[model samples]
Target: MLCANSAGRCEFDGCNKYIFYDNITAKKLNASNVAHIVAASPDGPRGDKTRSYLLSDKLENLMLLCPQHHKMIDDYVEDYPEELLLEMKKKHEDSIREMCDLIFVPKSERVIFFSPIKNVSLTHIDNQLTAQALLPQKRPASTCGINISIESAFDYNTSEYWSDIDNQLKRDFDRKIGNELDSDPNTIFSVFPLAPIPLIIKLGYLFMDKTNVDIYQKKRVPDTWKWIETRKTNSFSVNRIVVRAGSNIALIISLTAEINPKRVTDIVDADIIYIISAERIGVDAISSIDDLSDFWHVYQTVCDEIKNKECAVETSVFPAIPVSAAFEIGRRYMPGIYPKLHIYDDYNGFCKTLTIGGDC
Candidate 1:
């Protein structure tokens, strides 16, 4: 039961190493140690006079630790205090139990796609963080997920730096993801994207409506990959200005912050304009999955607006949105129905990063 609870791995928080065998050599190895949280002996590490006797051999006071951690904690009792040890042990066991419950639950392949935002402070995606985010709804499939990393050392600000980003995405994606889709096109993809708006949108665009995708937002405040435990409701307003009939229509999404009209006006010679803004906008505006659903509902309407035109009007998308929303924008863009999109990314200034549905 103890080994099962620890999932046959070390229970020292981040040190979740497997102890079954030498993975590289394929040799049987006793790589684990049964360590007492409150020492079985009174004078041992974290030993207590009364509690040591009470908890000796008790499952509650034991942890499945690797040999190294077992020795290190014994060596320095101060650093690995009783309370901290118990916390680690409890968290590890509870997490393991929760994971066990999800053995039969649906699995989602963690699709990781990221690029540098502002050419600084790139975010790292680990199974530890993404695993915590996947609970209650899906099981973490890190071992089998699709990973396509496109973090160029080149400056994101320079137009020349991004010329081949789409091509690279296609090449890597076709090599890894396209083959997977050919076998099982219905595979559920849990996308964790932290890239420029254009690339994420393109990522979503590539997936299209044909593929199943779950977008995970990286929250700014708590700095977590998990969705809010409870859904927080938000309200949005869609305002449109149809100046005159023309070949271009401007679709401006201002969710995180407001985008000045002049920025779009200077670049796009549009006859019609549509603005989708939240009642309250900020980094935390998109806090729940329901909020994304709300955006999707609004998004379909926007897509229909473009699709129903007498002639295919080219769409200019100027976005001030969270990464998740940008992705959805791409996912929903159907070539035959929706017009071509000239997606603008904010760097030093708005430079066209990608074009969706341009060919068809």
Candidate 2:
């Protein structure tokens, strides 16, 4: 039962080594062992008092662990104490249950064609696909040159101009795309980026953290669209803590360069804090997909910390990161397990909140 509860994998934190393997010849090899949270022997490590009298042979006192972890815990009882082992067992069991539930739920699929520019056309796409357009109210009849007539179609060359349009588009997306996601949490959204590159980045920022989505970019020659996947990045370290005052929220920051220290100091009162600084990798911008993957690893670690806590989560990014990396971050957040995400946006040199999911 313990192995089944752990989904046939190791229960150690962040160690998902599979215990049961079947080869092509149909021979099964098992490398898992049931480790007792409370030592079975009276003279064994962590075997004293209550454990000696009770819970020694009980199923509730056992945890499924890989061979290495089982040996390590037995060798170093001080590090893998009874309390910590019990907590890890509970968390791993809970995660398995959640995964089973998600596997059985039904999912609906939809394709969204978002074109905020004039020159791009979606007419060649299949008519059977559900198409939602975001065209301007009016456009010049002439087809000789590219003409943009959108309400917020401002110049993207200037930072101020792009920021204003980005904000406006954010509001628009919250109303339109956000509504669709709210209707069905299991909806598979396939998005095609046909707007300005900056707007595409803003579009990624607007996607509610944790929602399932796929991004695609168009290729010229034969005009084919390919799915873009976020690759795993190199590992990064984090500094995390849990506070007990103010808003019951977890703050996760990934700094590629540097952010305003004042902004971080302002939120020290949060229930939990997780900071992943750029100093770990010594890069201002995320140079590879591996960096983004590394960022995601830390993000998930922070998520694990606050999973059982009754609090919202706020993720803040410092300096500036690549749009692709931002998109990957938004994609990784699993809305069902994680609480509502409050993303911070800087407006007029002041931090503003952008709520994703949860009563927004």
Candidate 3:
């Protein structure tokens, strides 16, 4: 209840302040009626005595505000920040002086802590988290981090074994390329169709991704190989083969150019043959596909095992047979050996084969 005396004296502990009745107007005046310190709707039409207080004397809800002070609280409460209110409440607890500082000559003011509502950027944070989690998984384990040993096997032809390995690499490369090309028909074949050549040569690194390699290699190939262009002059040519992979072994060949190297190279001038095979080494961080570091380290290991001989560069590219001669022979005598390729070449670009054909 509001503090008022029998003679309408303000009974609040504050110094005497008396409310008087207007004798002429016959209206009794005193701080008796409960006043809402803050109005929920302050902007409503002012001075309309019909404006009602929301609650009275639940001390927890009501305040002992004079009429003028009541209006002031109402006006400011609309834009008040919850944090500022909570801070004011914390400073006012159990201390009249602090309460008076928060209010004007007050008894007590209630306290309330307003929690903040935050709007987070979910997409941005999620993307950052995803990158952090996935990057480590994608990284290849370093050789130092993992332990693996390699041993040499006595085989009839180390070159043949190497060739088989090269064939496996090529098949894998083609499969990967095929999967990528299924989406776009206009995309040309992979540039390194020669397969394991690129891996052994360290040139395959240029074709890191299938899409990029296809574009580059396609541009490099000439139609002359598929369609031989013979002028008035006869030219000597060479079929340069490149084998590549992450492994240390490689096979490359530069054969006499009668097969019309115009599509790839004009002359098989320099037969650059380098083979770096390994017998007992470690394989670490070597991708199953065209991997040069693996090839290099393995080559070194193989050379060391062979007492560091010059020919120990182990992997060598050799011309198994002349391309034209093979085609003619297969076509004439062993028609069964060669498939009757349609003149309308349906070559769907380079693809990985399941098996590396020995005869081809």
lDDT of each: 0.81, 0.56, 0.27
Mark the regions of model 1 whose C-alpha exceeds 4 Å error after superposition: 1-99, 153-159
Ranked candidates, highest lDDT first: 1, 2, 3
How would you encode candidate 1's per-residue C-alpha lDDT over 1-360 as one tens digit per residue? 789889999999799888888889999888889999889989998888899999998998888999989998899889999889989988988988876798998877888777777776575776567766777788865574677888666677666667667778878878877887888887778888877888888888888888877888887667678887467568777888876777578888999989887788888787778899987898766778788878878877876877585354478889899887888888887777777888888777787778888782
For each candidate, how many residue pairs have backbone atoms clashing (under 3 Å)?
2, 4, 28
Best by lDDT: 1
Question: Which candidate do you rate higher for lDDT, 1 or 3?
Answer: 1
- TM-score of the candidate numbered 1? 0.73
Instruction: Name model 2 segments beyond 4 Å from true.
Output: 1-234, 241-247, 250-252, 267-271, 279-284, 309-320
Global local distance difference test of model 3: 0.27
- C-alpha RMSD for every candidate: 5.8, 23.6, 29.0
**Candidate 1 least-lDDT 10 residues:** 305-314
Sorted by TM-score, highest first, which candidate order results? 1, 2, 3
Off by over 4 Å in 3: 1-160, 190-360
After TM-score superposition, what is the CA distance of residue 270 in candidate 2 from its true location, in Å? 3.3
lDDT of 3 by residue, 15-100 (tens): 12344554567787764333333332444312123332442223333334345434544466554333443333223333343323
